[model samples]
Target: MPNITGFLFLLLLLATEGSLGNSKNEVSHGSSQNVVGRPLGNSLNAWKYCQLGWSTYERRCFRFFKTALQWIYAEAECLRYGGNLASVHSANEYAFLKKLIHQGAGSAVKTWIGGHDAVKEGIWLWSDGSYMNFRAWNSGDNQPDNYKKNEHCLEMNHGAVQLWNDSPCYELKPFICVKK
Candidate 1:
């Protein structure tokens, strides 16, 4: 009977410790607080802000657009909505964006991603303060066509699925942006 009691006590202690560890991790991960009337750190938080749009899982915001636009205009629009164009950092993010695009959320036109070659004519950067690591450009695109010299904007053509083309900064198109 003494051994049985000791075993029960050990199990209880372990259960308690596990729960405590989960709570601590949640708090430290910056996902314990609710934002914009939605619970944080869940997929629902992504959909709660906008209708069927792209969501930044870590920062907590949904990006929306109906068409494509110039990089400058897209950035400005995101600012107006308290966010910026979506910056994809992982393969999961790339897949998610691709799925969103395929779902007709952005079916009409090629949308502007958050990347640009604006810094030094060839160096690409995302809007989220990260260096470009992954690219999804189309064939023969982003080849520095040198059409206008120093053109620095990027767009994802849905048809080609791997094309990224550069265009003038002033031309209007749809874009994605993120915000907290």
Candidate 2:
């Protein structure tokens, strides 16, 4: 029947398109030969903090800091390895970052996060040029707690459940950096 023939043709076309879509997804996920000409390392290895024993996933690198450093120094270190501190743009990403930090399993300390009110006081922005979407702050956080008026950098105090803290850019603290 001509109708049956046309239906089969349509089904075949749909199957082919599906296969193509899957191939593209695989390539994007770094499971295809499309990366042959690029560097030969897993996403974890390509991360900037691998030298510091941190891991990577899908072009993002993570690091755990036992000590604290100033924001500028932390940012410089991240730049040295082609990365900046981590920023969470979505709930899933926030969960993933929290998991990674939890894996480090160290004492609570204020660590530098990748956001600041640098451009204009009170206008926060991530180093990656993304807008501030979600903020995790503790009580009395971000209130300009009796410091100079020019403190522009942000930190996450683990003791406060990774709440935000604004501090001078030169204060030293251990920070996590992300690379892509």
TM-scores, each model vs. reference: 0.60, 0.60
User: Relative to the true structure, how large is the alpha-carbon lDDT of every model?
Assistant: 0.63, 0.66
* Lowest lDDT block of 10, candidate 2: 31-40
**Window of ten residues with lowest summed lDDT in model 1:** 24-33
Off by over 4 Å in 1: 1-60, 104-108, 139-150
- Expressed as tens digits, the lDDT of each residue in 62-157 for candidate 1 is 565765566787887887776777777666666666655556563535667777777777777877677677766555544545356855777665
Q: What residue runs in model 2 are displaced by over 4 Å at the alpha carbon?
A: 1-52, 56-59, 139-146
Residue 102 displacement (Å), model 2: 4.5
Q: How many pairs collide in each candidate, listed in order?
A: 15, 10
